[model samples]
Target: MSNTPSLTANLRSDLPAALVVFFVALPLCLGIALASGAPAFSGLIAGIIGGIVVGALSGSQIGVSGPAAGLAAIVLTAIGSLGFENFLVAVVLGGLIQVGFGLLRAGVIGYYFPSSVIKGMLTGIGLIIILKQIPHFLGYDADYEGDQSFWQVDGENTFTEIINALGNPSVGATTVGFIALGILLLWSNVLSNKGKIFTLIQGPLVAVAAGILYYVLTQGNPTWGVAPEHLVRVPVPKSFDDFLGQFTFPNFGAITNPTIWVTAFTIALVASLETLLCVEATDKLDPAQRVTPTNRELIAQGSGNILSGLIGGLPITQVIVRSSANIQSGGKTKMAAIIHGVFLLLSVIAVPTLLNKIPLAVLAAVLLIVGYKLANPATVSAIYRSGWKQFGPYIVTVLAIVFTDLLTGIALGLVVAIIIILYKSYQNSHFLHRVDSDDAAGRHHVQMQLAEEVTFFNKAAILRELDGLPEGAILELDVRKTRYLDYDIVEILENFATKARDRGIDIEIIAVGKRVMNPPSYMKFFDLAPAVEGH
Candidate 1:
């Protein structure tokens, strides 16, 4: 195993990456909070805590933490039921519960999830990103931005929301959004080819800058300019003291509320699952293929959430949006994560007015591009070529997310994946046993025949026959017709071989080939010999 990189070197490499992450995280922080029915300032608080606290404690090198869209539905419901102030209490408690989970080392739960389910989750989330962002891209503010559920707020569901948004479009916002998107695409392709300037400035930054400049030029003209409704409104804190005063304390009195407890538990469970899933996905994207410590990540997330909630912020987690951006930006350490947090804090305090100048339409364009990258056609094609087992779950997950909400869609996809795994297990093989009585000397003969492929799934039946065999009986294992055997099954056979010898039973392994019988002692019977003459 390679030793952990030095902290000084890690920090140096992460600073520049963190600057990139800050740009990515800023709009998402505000957008998610706006979508979750929480105060926009609260989202900034969560981002700051996630970066400064979570990033400091996290074991993951590249995963950036912040308020997630996955928790939007839950937060909206919790606030409606418990009231915003009371909900803050639940958020704080949820962070505490997450801390407890980390101390208990519950992060291993992430590893138990099947690969199919995980892939489904990624695809589902990608589709959700695309679906939820479409309204924003079109400049329709009917629903809160970042709402991923198929259902919309106007009493209409997902389908209705689309219809309504299409019927009543904000032409000004739409035009600006498209213009910004065009600029981004052009910048990514043409401008990037020019030199160092394009290399240093990303497409998103360019889009945002152009949108701000456009807004500045058209500020006096109502018809041509972007409206206040379509712009990002960051809370303006007059002074350093005023900025510090924006932080709210959790209402600890709500601790006794049963609803609060339920909300806390829900946040803990969902956030942990999301974090683990993101961690796994991040590892796959890592060029070095390093595995993060899942348990440690939970602890870091827990601490970050605690700080966020204590300061009257939303729940926090390892958000894939920022993490993907971090990786794509060449972030190599946790320092990038910490720096992003610092930028969030500074932007809100020192430059809140400048940030507000950036039009929402431009931000929408940035998100649309991000969503497109996530749900790219190439990704879908790659998943399809991996086979139905992979593609089936992937497609189901995407559809579910597009049709429903994040958690529900993931659950449904997971159920489908489990069913597929079980079906594959059943198709692998059958087990059979035979016993015959010989007239001469009253001897008995026992035989066990395995199908072409025997896996760990059939261990119970094999073990039962081996244990039930009578002493002094002649035992025979017929593998001549078997084509493949799982390694786990072979180990069981090897153990049984040792026990049978001690029991004085006559044991024979039929059709052992010179090459096949040479299996390592740990996996003696797992070998597949060439087919012998006759059945």
Candidate 2:
């Protein structure tokens, strides 16, 4: 399939998807901003830059970018340790490093990510979203927004928080969360399927609208009145100047701060890794199976973070939550992603007050649906059915990510994948079979056929096979299918050939390049034993 696209070709599909993404992204942006311990407007700024700048420059058709929940902990720590103004300088510096990474062709690293690990990453994030949102759904509001790490900013872990939330649940928030969840389920299954009118009217939008209406109606009631802390808290600017004043500028003087530079480098490395992983996952999720240019994606992300930092925004990355929503909503091109950004800009500029009126529990319900789709039981079972080669890494990645950070989880999964590859290589380096030709020489023919590739790892296996060869045997060492043979393996075969002659073994080398020999002079050159010497 062609990688390029016409803007208008997917307009119908893209437009509806963009609306859905906007509705999904709005709360996340505000929530992530609140989580980062930064001004609320900063999250919106990042959302805008990610959508408009990255969405425009990126080669990914459906992947969406925004201030990510994954980066919330890092941002929070960075701001607290480096000071908010200095952290802004770090974000800008991190963006510059990402750009350099793109130029260095580091994007090629994305291709090496294992597919099972990618799926596990998606599944792991989904499980984390679900786990992290439970307290919010119950309106506990103890931990700040966008806190997904197992060890929360609060002293409690995820399970402990859930237990605590159950002990002290809010009646109003629970009611809103349940009602919103119902509306989301209904819209996804019934009304949204009825016709075009309902398709464009997304489930989350309706859920948010319903929650806001409920909040207003129940304001004075004793049983259902929602607490102020449980509600969303967007900065309600009094005028245009007040809105502009909310934007914080980076302090260029922080350039000399070594901690800022270290934080910047850390952010750049982690952000780049997350972006590459998401890009890989999103491409897999795409129905058309289009490949994204990983290098261009880094450039887009770099540009977005640079602009976002200048305007006092949180760090941005390619977010799977919004991207998966776009795909599920039938987005066919990058236009949907860009249009969602446009909505984020217009919403803050035009209706920040109305947006602020929405309840956090409602957004939690929407995210719960996304989480369920990602970590469905069927997906887990299917991966298991693929066998341990896939399931081991898949489960390990999920567990690691759920327990640790995204990069660590992926790294563990990759290590497992590499181990499996090495094990398989060691297991299947060659095939040894015995055949007898009747009425010929009345001799047994033992054929050793080489595998497609051989490396130093296969030396022991080949040596064992050679040592097991029977005396006076008619042996055939075949290398016809071998594409790669390590020097150690060649030396083993050459040394074995010398011993075979003494043992009265008829060894016929087949398809091996050049006569393999243990040259005494060559061995002396490296101060090693000659290949022809007996062990």
Candidate 3:
């Protein structure tokens, strides 16, 4: 088991990683809100809560939590149906429900998920990222700006949106986007290998800087300059008072609404699942392959959601986008997570105006790269190599996620994976009987071959056969070939052996090592009998 290290080492590893996470998180915060039809500030609040509150409470060193794209569609529908004020009440209640889940110890579900499905999920998500970011890269904003669905935003569906964006392109935005893309590609592929300058400066950072410079050069011009429509337009609060004025409070009065309760439960369940999945996936990506504590993560997420809801912010979870960025950026501890939160808080206060200057196109370019990496072909190839048992579930999960919404797709994949597991278990639990008879009394012998390993999954099959044993039968359990047997099966066998002795049935064991049957001195009378050869 891995132990949590000292605070000093954590700080040293986390600080720099947090900086990278901050950069990755900023746009996502804004984009998710835009997609969900919520106030852009809501996303920022969620990010802050996810980092400060969730980060502090979570057991994961590398998992970064924040507003998730997966929840955007749900949030959008809930707000529209329940009204924004009432929806917020549900969000608060949702956090409370998540706390309940932690208390119930429901976090272990993550462990049962098939490895194939999980791999497929990661690869599918990566592909979606690449596809969704294309319009933004081309300066063609077809969808509601931050949509993550496979279908397009022009009310035409995903495929149509791609076509429409291609049909109509904004030259100025496209040019800036292409330039940014070129710079990113060069920095990642070529520049990083050459010198210290390349090593120190990331491609995304350079693309953003170049974009801002381009905007500045074309500041006064009408045709060449980046337009306001193409820029990231955060609410510009003029002063500290104005900024404070932007904060919205939840409608505590709506707490009694049944609709509020339903939405709350929905948010809590969906958010918790997403967080668990992301934590699992992020851990796999970690160079160290560290396992995060799922229960602790639930507690942290619940706390963050509570804070976010209280502040009239969006619900949050362990977001893979920022978490992956943290890993890639060489983050080593939770300090990076805390620092990223601080950066979010400071940026809104100290450099709100500067942030406002960044073109949405530039951010789009950054996301395009992030998305491509998530859904890359290399990931698919890797999954395929892990064997069909893993690949089958993985592919199913990927397709489900892509064709439908995230939660629905995951549920489908999980069910399929579970069925496969049960089928394999049943196939492994077979008993073969070979009988030889030559006398007038019709004497016969039976031999049962235990599986290579027996587990609880095979208990039913073994039990059914043992319960139906015939009278005057000679039973021989062959353990010479069995390497390991689960304690559950062993206990059952012991009981059956006692019953067989009572029934006057002949029972014998083969190759039973001394280590197999060391009864307690108190129960010496019931001590295990020795094995017989060819009984």
Candidate 4:
């Protein structure tokens, strides 16, 4: 059977998935835009391009693209540091660099990230989603919806914001939050299994429709009415020209600036990593377990961002949040993603007023569910059981991301992974054994076989073995399994050879019968001869 299914084969499934994703993505786009310090419509632009442009170009069957919450902090800082127009230039430049990465096959870098770290990233982002959304969930939305940073622009940290949310809650917002949350939980647990009709209507969409109704009905009661500030705010163009005028053009003249290039490279690097990571994660969430061609995904993302930047949109990436929602909603093909994009574009133009009626609290409740799925305690326990080598990086990554930012947390995890590798190399560099033979010679044999690859890090262990040998013994230095021996170890062997006679020890060195690799320059610089002798 063919791996790729016909796009129209699953329209029954894809259509509902598309509607569900459309509802899920709408608030996220607006929220990420607000968080990034960009005009809210810019996020919709990115989301639209992500769904139509990237989704159409990508080979991923279930993965969805959008303005990522992970990039919000970067977008916010870049806009402030470079000015909005200059930052748009950086975004464009970043898109070109991403295209280069795709061409160069830099997508393979994603494979190098440890599984523990990747899990940590997902879990970390999940926690960030939960923590950052608490205020909005409670209706005191002083901060933007998708602001994932530890220290917010409002000068309140994640903890302080939570405390404040508890102190001052909005009755309308709080009421909508619980009601929406209840509706989601009920739909997911009970109603979703009822029939086709229930499945077709997504919990999020239903919750949103209910919230909008609640908002309209509560208008007469001031205390329980959701304020305009707590509702979705997509710009409604006065006319066609006004709609076109919303997009801000990049300042191409700023391309020559060094700061612009630096910002571009940073955005390119970070966005690419985030995209690749999400690709891996979304594949796991796929029911069919279909794989995404990551390099092609990079190209699609590059193209989308280029278009998005030209028309004033936040940078786009394959976002796990929306992609997961799409998958969980039973999205079958790229068509679902494309349809969601079309909906986004049409909604702002045709029914911005209807979307504006959605209370932010309802969206927060929806995200809270998604956040919980990402950071499930079961997932954390499974990671812990994978042993310290995996857990160390995983836990550190989670903590770092929770306390700091996404990039910093991953950096710390990578460092821990390297440390684990080095420690294992140091401990497992060689095999040591003792042999007592009842031969005519009556010789006691001590054998030490070198690991497949030995470097300077193993020198101390080799030296300690050599120094502790008995006064009269046969020491077998086995290099038969060694692929490459370091110069430092060679020098140690040579020095020991000179002292072995005085200590009444006879040493025999063994190397592979196959041809030996010539020593590196470092060996020659040390003037140490190879201790290997072919059988």
Candidate 5:
């Protein structure tokens, strides 16, 4: 798929989308860093690398890469075991491993997944976004902002956090959140169409500005004051040198430790999987329906992670949240992603203090819209209409993601989909047509045509049909359409031929080479064909 968006063709569309993605990505960078128990500046570094480096290299038009919430737990544990400095070594090694994965073309694994599971993943992540954002929206900011797992980094599960937030809502934050949500809704559904200025000046930026205004105005009103914790918390550097000092380099001296290698491999595996999955989902979400080069994406992510670790940053992945936000915000090119990275860098250097004043609730409002679009009820209804065969894996994936985590949920959904495939294979091994007319020899004709693939799964079904045949019947078994015939199935057919002879039933085999009447050995009939050149 063509992902090369000409600079002139997409500037107008990409600019506003880039701004929206910047606003969305800023807090997530900080939150995911906090959740990972790393320096807050690390997340920003990763975001910068993911956006500029990965965005420039990736074939994806809308996919946004950054520090992912799904890897927070692993980062936290690794930091505890290896210490922060040494852990950076693992991160760098992981990046190299990812680069190796890309070179090896392991990205093809993404295509093996069923469509039901992919849809389920998208819907599940959408629900997760909405569910995880509630507390932040209500001003209960105990948990980190980008926490997507059911069990949060703050020791609270998804539902329990909402329950707690309901009992302790911040009037100031709630008010700002509602107003921002209103602006977003109005901008998307009404104002954007009425004028180009509204489109250029995206609703998210307006909402954030409004949120900052509210925070400044209500600082002293006890009942309405937005607390420090309820706002964006970017680290403010006092001077140029202080800003430079925030970057922490890896302790490469510890690279020889076996534990470091193991950790590196773990990060590489999980991060690659997450990146591939996001590539598939982001491709599906793109308006142009352009397909991303998965192998190139892995290389891009690896390069980003390596750069991020060299200076101080969390591991990188193609994050669905920011990607979905970019898509929903009208981002049409990789330019949007590249520009968002530039915004992140400029924000850190130029206006961090101003950013810190914006309320988290406003960002939550932006995400709520993104979440709703991804998990639209219309999508669910349409999938349901496709029948249980399609809906089962989709719903399972959705629920599992809600209750567990993204990777685990997809694994479970795949298991269900595979089981369904096997069951269908068992039921559809062959087609049968029996003519009721009796010949002069008092025999009925039965024709059985095999399916494309007759594996061991079909043995039982084929055997049952053969055993039920009448004594005075002429059976014509057709294998011309079969691409693969398992040894188990072939043996079943050979045994059935012997039983047919005893029952006074005539057997005819219609195979690739020729038709045979009551062949002494079915294996010999298959063996007579020339072997494939390669095998």
Candidate 6:
């Protein structure tokens, strides 16, 4: 773990980064809610809780939690199966389950994910972001902003949606998106190096401000003006009382339902897995390479989900997009995430109308830059150079994610990674060499050294080597360096001793640097017979 900057000391950097994340999260919160078929305000509530509560408790400095697009389908189904109020009960129970998972140290499950898969996940998400944002950038708001699934709820797949956007591009939105992109590129490549002014005020904030100004100046011009439908849609309340009325309480009476329990477990498992994965990815993205305590992250996310459910918000999980945005924007502490939540809370109550005035295209442009940074060609090239064993899983994860969904893609990637591991294990179980090729009497002398740990997976390789030994051969089986010898492998050696007798082959078993001629038995030497019999 690396030290995180104190909130007071990191404020200057965190503040600007927070603003950038706020712009990116605002629409995502609403869009995920929309896609989930939940109340629009629920997403906002989740964003606030995820930022304020989870940020405070999480060990992560850069991870940002909110309503994730990955859970949209689950939420939609859960809400439809159980009524909205009953679903809230499930969310609360799910939070409790997540907290239990943290206490049980289930977070260690995250460590099993291969590094190639994690890298693939980041790159896959980057590609998804770019593909999903294209339509929004072209002013075609047919699909929700944060939808990451290849087949969208809007009756079109990722590619089809992009095709549609190309056919019907909005002039005003397109112009503004390109302008925002240009400004972002300029600020990043040129202006930011000029002085402290560019550093203090983020490019995203500037692009948003310019976008609002453009929208205002061209509202009446049909050709150049962005439509109202293409703007951020925050649920605005008519009065302070109405604002407070927005919060919906869960149906405590429905807690006894078995369906609710099932939903709760599903949400808890999925949310915990997503949070753990994001923790790994965020740690990798951190310039300081700080390791976040995974169990603590689970508890933090669980707490956030609890509060979110109580207040009619969606389930919370650490999201990579916002986390990456925080890192790329130079955030040095969790305060950046917390403050972004505060911005969300204050914005809905104070100036939602103003937020609604900003074009979605501008935010789309911001995400475009973030996506490019995540899925850059350099990252792919580096992974490819690591060798096919690594690159296979990395590319598989990327393609699966782009073609399917997040969890499914990760599952497939893990399968590929496991197969690769087995393949490597089979090939590297032992080292065989011909010692002093053919002794004085022309007898073949072969030495086979066992690996540090030899399991049943290595049985085939060892078997092949033993069967290839010629008649009248002198064989030395070395176990001096081996720490673990599986019963299956020992059995193979025991069975081979019988054949060695018929073939006129001499067998020498070396253990602890001592050679035993015609050893009494391999089963007794390795002491694995009883363990295997017990099983």
- Which candidate should be chosen as best, given TM-score against the real structure? 6
What are the per-model numbers of colliding residue pairs?
Answer: 1, 0, 9, 0, 0, 0
The models' CA-based lDDT, in order, is 0.76, 0.84, 0.76, 0.85, 0.91, 0.93
What is the TM-score (0 to 1) of candidate 2? 0.90
Worst 10 residues of 1 by lDDT: 526-535
Clashes (candidate 6): 0
lDDT of 4 by residue, 386-477 (tens): 89999999999999989988778889998999899888887888988998663467767888888878888887777888898887788776
Model 2, 124-144: lDDT tens digits are 988988998889899898887
lDDT of 3 by residue, 1-535 (tens): 7466654676645665576577668877888898888889999999888888788888888788889988998899998888777788888888888888988888887787666766767777766666666666666665655466765334665566667778876666777888888997888788878986775656777787888888888886766677767777667788889898777888888788888898899899899999888888888888877898888788788888888988878999998878887777667767677788988888888888888777767877777777677777787888789777777788888888777656666778888888788878876775668676723666456677776666778888888777776766777666656555666777787677777767665666654563322222212211342332211
Question: What TM-score would candidate 4 get against the native?
Answer: 0.91
What stretches of model 5 exceed 4 Å from their correct place?
1-3, 529-535
> What are the per-residue Cα lDDT tens digits for candidate 5 across 55-160?
9999888899999998999999999999988999999999999999999999999999889999999999999999999999999999997888888877899999
Spell out the clash pairs found in candidate 1. Answer: 150-158
Q: What would the TM-scores of all predictions be?
A: 0.79, 0.90, 0.80, 0.91, 0.96, 0.97
Candidate 1 lDDT score relative to the true structure: 0.76
Q: Encode model 6's per-residue lDDT on 1-535: one tens digit a residue.
A: 7255777798999999999999999999999999999999999999999999999999999999999999999999999999899999999999999999999999999999999999999999999999999999999999997899999998899999999999999999999999999999999999999999999989999999999999999998999999999999898899989998999999999899999999999999999999999899889999998999999899889988888999899999999999999999999999999999999999998999999999999999999999999999999999999999999999999999999999989999999999999999999999998977677799999989888889999999999999999999999988877877777887899999999999999998777746678877877656632222211
For model 5 the TM-score comes to 0.96
lDDT of 1 by residue, 1-535 (tens): 8666655686644665677677667777887888888888888889999998998899888889999888988898998898888888888788888889888989998787667666666666666666666666666667666566777554666667766768876776777788888987897769878987776666666777888888888886767777777777789987878877887887888689898999999999999998988888777766667788998888888888878888889999998778877776667877888889998888887888998887777777766666666677888898899999888777877788778877777677788888787777665454445555574766568766667667677777678778888776777677766766777777787787788778766666666553332233524333334542111
Error of 1 at 9 (Å): 5.0
Q: Model 3 off-target regions past 4 Å?
A: 1-16, 151-154, 219-225, 431-535
RMSD per candidate (Å) reads 8.2, 4.1, 6.4, 3.7, 1.9, 2.0
Better of 3 and 5 by lDDT: 5
Span of 10 residues, lowest total lDDT, candidate 5: 526-535
lDDT of 6 at 23: 94
The better-scoring model by lDDT among 1 and 4 is 4
